[model samples]
Target: EKEKKEKKERKEITPEEIMKPYGVSVDNIDDDEVRVLTKENLYDTLLSLAAPVRQLRLDNSEKEDRESGRRVVIGMVGYPNVGKSSTINVLYGSKKVAVAATPGKTKHFQTLFIGEDIFLCDCPGLVFPSFISTKADMICNGLLPIDQMRDHRPPISLVCQRVSRESLEHVYNIAIPKPAPHLPPDTIPSPDDLLNSYARARGHMSVQGRPDESRAARIILKDFVNGKILSVVPPPILMNGLDAHGLQKLTKDFNLIGTKPAPIEDQDKEKKRKNRLLNQQRGQRQYTDEDEMDRMVRLDSVGHHQGGKRGGKNFVQNKNSNKPWLEMKRAQKAQKRAKKKR
Candidate 1:
């Protein structure tokens, strides 16, 4: 009777109960010590992280006490375009390292100092082979530039998998258009459906009046990396993860765009209206073929193509996509090889 009662009281462990939350945890550092640094308390955070290292440096430099204090080097490491340079600039209070929205901008590591007490070693962003799951994930995380993407489908699909479609609609302020035949009321929008709606809303369409999937994908990926489309991953300990309803609630609570902003005054509204009109006028103005040709000539004269893509992406930027000269050289080599064989 006692054994039966105990057995009945015991709860069975479900598969969903076994998984932990996804996050970084350093064993050496106290939970209190690990913090998300912001622009406001960045210096303090840096100093705190470097405290032990700085102390060791000071102890070693004690013999040379007659000289100036030695600086402790803090190496900044992460995947490309993860904002290493931006963090350093914030710490140094200047544009000490070149910063851009794209990946692989910082080709080389740079050594910089802060107030003779802390030395910042900014390393070029690196992507680990093992950590990479898909190209779309990399692009969505800002490890790859959206413009250089040949295909946007995989990554957009990954986005839908990680985040709910309704959350995307909220972020982009768009609704999926009703199908000719109604889907179940509970049916969710597919990534393609979302992209089509997004493209239409953003006016990203092809010359043929079709929604440009590539352009829409790029825009969606950009918004995602910029934190407009956020995925609410519950910590492993948080109730075995959130369901669709729970996720929807979480998204609504955490989504910045979901919140309503205060009404703008008439003066501010008028200024915005004027700006909108100006932009419309500028966009409406069309250039003739001759004008375009002349503009291209002028741009070439100023060495516009010399630097390649923005943010020092000279290495990865393709200068000649067609590669006519390369193809000709390959053909000549092949001809010579065939003649020799004969």
Candidate 2:
């Protein structure tokens, strides 16, 4: 009876009875710093996973003279006509690079060595999903200058449609309404004839009548010239591929259109700017510091910054799209939950 009663009492133990022995042990599990279930892990778990890897990030050092690494050598890579040359031209404050209304104007890896140590490398515009996947190969011949792309760019297949002799002939028909230069002046048909001919060739048939040639021409031109119909932009890694350093250095000090930066310039510049501002402000406390006086003084003193929109980006900037997309890769690795350093 004693043994049976002892067994029954042990079986009837409550929830608290089983857990109290290991309570402190379970809460503070750490064997040689291999941790488990710490309170810090409960929050910011996703942030720990999503944050960028920073350990091997190259320590960007600045050199003022003609030293080895004074500037950030950035190569603008994107689809043809995505504003590669225009960007380079504006960056160095000169039209050293070519800007045209046609596609594929820049054909060289034109390196403009701007200011001491700062070199602006203007590469040819690359076309994506074309001959290959690497940026170097597409740009090997020259940069493909495409139209200014806002959104989805048109497909090359559509570009093929617009490259026909008939479309050019049609535009000449409606706009000029006369014989084409390529064709004889006397033999050239009326604009309506050319439109009808184009429509018949493309097989545009209306429900009540023959094919609508004018509408067909408009549709073809829309796809070729306008991006509303398609959204294909170029890739950087063309058929040529990236070099070892080009591949490695893309981690921290990297950017392009379609990306954002943390902001640059030294803490000293910030301090000096603030001091100059404070001095100007203190001087202006009295009516003697007239608006015209301050303006004239600044016009002579600093020159440009206090003025309107000087050196600020006036247009939308373009950048590489693949880098951010590649951040979440797993074989790539993850990091320990960042300890909020005291």
Candidate 3:
């Protein structure tokens, strides 16, 4: 009865209540509602959002100044490295604004005219203060740059806790040492073990011939940020059989159409096949006029010239198809026969 009551209580707790301790307000979260949009469809989504502004401009077109009324200004502001410049570049269909993985790349406000009447204002990214539980959490969330991090162990430890040792090994192609038998079976591998193994595998050694953990840590953190580790936090409200937006379907499709290249064995087989064909062509004898005449004489000797057929089947000529050389040879043979009769 106690277990059942605890399960009921846990089920009754809302996502907002769960996040309240983390200083995150779910109700105050207001960003783009559309989670996914392809580049081809971005224009349509932007047009839908701009419909109201376009209508307002049309309604006040007569009273407002001609220049001001025709133009539409949209300002983009968000946290650092949250794709503000990338979004503008996508809308413009070219790389107008500079974008980088590190934050604070856009240091000042800039204006760009994407369309005839639409002006996009890109403001510098701002970092807002929040009640963070630990510095590791901030680093894991990519709020701190990995290259500038003084201590990388804490954030790497957080990653080790979230991602399994097998997954890390597969990604980095290095084996991490397992914990001692005296420790609990559930104990995860330490950041030191992963960093040491990864550093050794990548040949990142220090001056003293020790594994360079700092360099390995930067590489691992970059992979984590770029989604190579494949970590994601699903929304609390998400439920099975209730994906109205078909995001789950799209994800499955993307997985089916993987971006990875073919296996090494397959690539090697293709190269070998190409080389074999090239060698075979090089080894074979080349075609010449003498070879063509010898082939025609051999065919006539074999009684293949009767009715322009070979073994009672229509003879197909070479790729040139004109057969003018064969006709000239036949004329010279007829002239030699007439001179012998004279």
- Tell me, by TM-score, which candidate is best: 1
1-342 in candidate 3: lDDT tens per residue? 966765555434354664454455778765677467887687676666776887788787776565677677778887778899999998878899999889778988999986677788999887666756777777777766778889999999988876665556655656666679898654678989889877766667665456789999988888888877655343444345334333333222222222222112243553464455445444443334557776875565454322357788886555323556766777787899999999
Ordered from best to worst TM-score, the candidate numbers read: 1, 3, 2
Query: Can you rank all candidates by lDDT, best first?
Result: 3, 1, 2
lDDT of each residue in 1-342, candidate 2, tens digit only: 966765565444332332343242324434565544333452233234323322112234333532554343556677676677876665546677888746677778877664453455777766666657543223221232232322211222333222322233433222213456787543424435445544544445453345475475455444444432222221332214544333222211121211222223354654464455545445555445355444544344342332234378454322322234233322133332333332
lDDT value for candidate 3? 0.68
- Residue runs of model 3 more than 4 Å from their true location after superposition: 1-40, 53-70, 131-135, 232-342
Per-prediction TM-score to the true structure, in the order listed: 0.55, 0.27, 0.53
Residue 236 in candidate 3 has what lDDT? 44
Worst 10 residues of 3 by lDDT: 255-264
Please report the candidate that would top lDDT against the real structure.
3
